[model samples]
Target: MAILTNARMPVETVNFHLWQPCNMKCRFCFATFRDVRGTVLPEGHLPRRDAERVVTLLADAGFTKITFAGGEPLLCPWIIDLIRLAKGLGLTTALVTNGSLIDSGTIRDLRGILDWVTVSVDSVRSGTLALIGRMTAARAADERHYLDLCDRLKDAGLRLKINTVVTAANHLEDLTGFIVAARPERWKIFEVLPVQGQNSGKVEPLLVTPGQFARFVARSRSVEAYGIRVVPEDNDAMIGSYAMVDPAGRFFDAIGNGYTYSEPILRVGVRQAVSQVTVSRRKFLARGGLY
Candidate 1:
């Protein structure tokens, strides 16, 4: 049976995640790719030319937008070449990073080739961040640093988006003020969700009930008045909704308790490879995946 009941929708957007490692230690991150790390992707990521070929496949597969994601995409030295290739192929290129490696110079470099960026900001409180393990080199970035980073992105004329994962550690904290100040075109709010092979065992302390997630959404609704679109994604809406490529460049989705992956795209091609995984267009739309 098709994973999505409707049975018809082209995968228009994909998160092409790099195989590199992240600098931060976010305990709730479901894309850690820990299972394949050091084994499947011994080199951390694909070679420069190979990575560019993957971009070509995504563009050829009819995807209109591609978000370069990672453990941290900025960590990949040849990311600029891939970005250039994706954009040249008429794909709207974007990035999802921790923002630790970004600065004015970096934003200036990305100003034209990249369309926007989504920085993960789970909590503004240092104490909350510490508990959630969103730290780099054992030091947590303060609220001021993040706000300044937002300003840099904005000043460069690059569109901005903020991604926040609401967990037990930060579900009660009010984020409307921060969201408003950030002035992002969109804000993605995700409830802490566990996934096998990634964060299954590590997320016990970060779990929150659906009710708590809803409460956090309600609290953050004030940002809408500031002309920011807030998109909230619950657990069900998240599963199988996204079209994602892991470090090995294979499609993957979580239709059941764990993820199901396809053969590498380089081997089979997009149509054949996508068939092995599940992606629900209905749930994708419901989760505000289209932007």
Candidate 2:
């Protein structure tokens, strides 16, 4: 049975994957955008004015918050300009990055307008990160590097979020100690997901059983006492819960197995474009997408 929605959609948040190139190649990344990378947009992203237009369209569409993510958003040269413009438009801005490019300079650039910085830290161990392809170099201070990033963001008065995807490689590793030390405002623990068009075949080795994912969640409970909201998202909880956009500025949704994309919002306009895919505000809330 199909669920019908009202025409009046109150979009609270949207994740804008503005860039398609990344420095670090994680094995389980679902936002690779490899399919549309060179073919869809020649520059790997929308041109400057078009990029700003997309953000403007989103703000005018009344989205409360917009999360800037990418293959690695920091790699995009003009992303700060977009972030600053989004803030000026009255939309709460957030960034999801692998944390490699973030430095004192980047932090200084985002100090006032950027509300949250969510870093993807699956494991502090270099060997495991190598297996998962999260990071290439075996830096001696890997643990210290990430933990320090938490402190730096917090010190800048920007909210911190740590996203740990429990995979076969790090499912057994207890990240509670790290979580306690870093002390982020929110710790989002996601079971390694396999999206068809995104990471179907590539995600198989990284996938964990539900029980294994459960075990990881159980051990992570200790962080709640430290005022960290540990939110676990299994596959079911993640489906159809987010309003996500691709690098070419089109709305996309995760269907039964593969992804279904809308006509580019730039071409079709916001309402027609968003209507091409189904989004559940009810599901979004249940998944704790807000805050």
Candidate 3:
């Protein structure tokens, strides 16, 4: 197939999802999952081939930056190999993960391959934890462990971006405290996206509307004061990154949705995928969106 990615808008960033299911069933996540069956890794569904094709596609599409994301990217088993491949291609690679996967081995493997890592930290206490559907039976220790990992990562000279998905369930009174607590070099804030399907009804009332989200942004300026660069999701400078690809070799739209193509690009080759990405991006941009 001859895919044509001939768009005028400078494509700069690309994001890929290593897996669809996540360990922490966060209330606001839209990514599909297999929570009911309690199987995080479905049978016969590994993304190796797809990720390989994605690297080639992004490289051809003029993408210099790439991000690997998932319900939890670290769960992909061969995440280190994927990062190495992306780095070998001269692409700055990033991992968007839940901090639960942080460990000495993971950190050691990422030492040179990854350019930046972003981990989700919703709240300080267990109450807020339940709000996100990730709870602690007793007093939680995972938060402390994650913080320690963050410190270690920083100490190892890795760039860290803390991702906070703001929802009504968050401790609004101590919102600033939460961001400051992470002490990340870069902090990215997001309006809680309502997750639909089996997890929908339980989380609907917790979401902040667009108007309320704007108000929250107005109130949380402490990230800047703390010397952390706050990258709000809606900012033009924070808009469409250099390039974004999915585990299935599908390019992502500016706001992180998959490209509108008839088939999964992973089934094809790099050149064809790039052509499709270019075509999809041009169509997406001309349509006009908050992204």
RMSD of 2: 2.0
Each prediction's Cα RMSD? 2.1, 2.0, 5.3
TM-scores of the candidates are 0.95, 0.95, 0.77
Question: Over the stretch 142-178, how does candidate 3's per-residue lDDT look in tens digits?
Answer: 5666668788888777898887777778626455665
Per residue, candidate 1 scores C-alpha lDDT tens digits across 71-126 of: 89999987887898899999998999888999767887898899988999998888
**2 versus 3: better TM-score goes to:** 2
Candidate 3 ranges beyond 4 A from true positions:
1-10, 33-47, 135-143, 171-173, 195-199, 234-244, 252-262, 268-291
Error of 2 at 11 (Å): 3.2
Query: Backbone clashes in each candidate structure, one number apiece?
Result: 0, 0, 13
Report the C-alpha lDDT of model 2 over 2-89, residue by residue, as the tens digit.
Answer: 1334644445898999998888778899888887774777667888799899999988776879999998999999989999999999
Off by over 4 Å in 2: 1-10, 136-141
Error of 3 at 126 (Å): 1.6
Q: How good is model 3 by TM-score?
A: 0.77
Q: Worst ten-residue run, lDDT, model 3?
A: 282-291
For model 3, state the Cα shift of residue 244 in Å.
4.3
